[model samples]
Target: MASQAFEEIAETFEFLDDWEDRYRHVIELGQELDALEEEFRVPATKVDGCASQVWLMPAVKGQGADAIFDFRGESDAMIVRGLVAVLQALYSGLTVREVLEVDAGAELGRLGLDEHLSSQRSNGVRSMVERIRRIAQETL
Candidate 1:
């Protein structure tokens, strides 16, 4: 289900005329995410080294089925939230191999993102890819 959603998001990008509208769409999706508050503790084990606190919880139905990653993140930076949304859109539903196959850097380039990002934002993205790959490794 989530995999289909991701592909649809990619298609949405395809439909966009330019990066301006695409960024608005990205921001909108970021707003859609369930933000974790002070009272909420989704767990830190799956929280990777994000500049802002990020939570990732995944469930596996069975072999060959994709994992569903439930994410919650909070950051002062709106762009960071948008980056998380991009990660969620790309990686939420994927088999271990599929996760391994995802070219995150390439994907970022395709989105016309990352080049103008600050060092901190770049680090945050690296953290996300590391966490995701770590999860994928664990499933193996």
Candidate 2:
């Protein structure tokens, strides 16, 4: 289940005439995200498979399957940061159970991100999705 924020991005991507414009939109989205606090950037939060340094701090409210799943993330690379923002839109604010139920690749594919991104970037996205899913699963 894609969030409304993610759907808006998809809609914007559809409205853009070219990949360059869409790329810029993604970068702009990244620029809009709140900066991750330094304390949250430690080794334990770091996502290993990304080419650039990336960290995600998961936050949960309540308990068990109904807990809300939210996370804040940052990346040293601008495009990667944008990807993180995209992930935020895709997954944030869902119940932990809902987060686990999401088909991340399918939802992202609707935006045609799979075709536009480089292999390394694609792998990084997968890594991020996995991390998000793992966090949700553990919370459950």
Candidate 3:
């Protein structure tokens, strides 16, 4: 599953190719993600300590292993928004434990994201992933 997600992420970045294109793709992915109903959209689903406004909604698809996630994020910063989309694509629809176990920092680094970002921006991206994992752990 991780490998599959990795491949998907690689494809995503490849599809975008350039920084401008990447940002557009990210926002596009966010647009593609359907928003959850208001009832399930609670404070508990919110990811804390993020530089961008981020909301995460987790749904158990079937049994204990199948799970799905819906992420809604808005950011004044375009790159930050793109970063959110990367997380959504890689981690959504994974099992709770699988989501928790994703090493987003490493994954992002492997994808050469940090090289393209400022230190502060990279930190913000890390904060988003950690917070998402925390939310998943809380729900699990």
Highest TM-score scorer: 2
**Which one wins on lDDT?**
2
Estimate the lDDT of model 3: 0.65
How far out, in Å, is residue 79 in model 3?
A: 3.0
lDDT of 3 by residue, 78-112 (tens): 56656766777677667777887777777776667
Using all chains and alpha carbons, the TM-scores for the candidates as numbered come to: 0.72, 0.97, 0.67
Ranked by TM-score from best down, the candidates are 2, 1, 3
lDDT of 2 by residue, 1-140 (tens): 98889999999998998989989999999999999999899999999898889999998897888998889999999999999999999988899999999999999898788999999999999999999999988997
Summing lDDT over every window of 10 consecutive residues in candidate 2, give the lowest-scoring window.
59-68
Candidate 2 stretches with Cα past 4 Å from truth are none
Pairs of colliding residues, candidate 3: none
Task: At residue 106, give the lDDT of candidate 3.
Answer: 78
Off by over 4 Å in 3: 1-6, 15-17, 35-46, 60-72
Q: List the residue pairs that clash in candidate 2.
A: none
Q: lDDT for every model?
A: 0.68, 0.92, 0.65
Clashes of each: 0, 0, 0
Better of 1 and 3 by TM-score: 1
Model 3, position 9: C-alpha lDDT score: 68
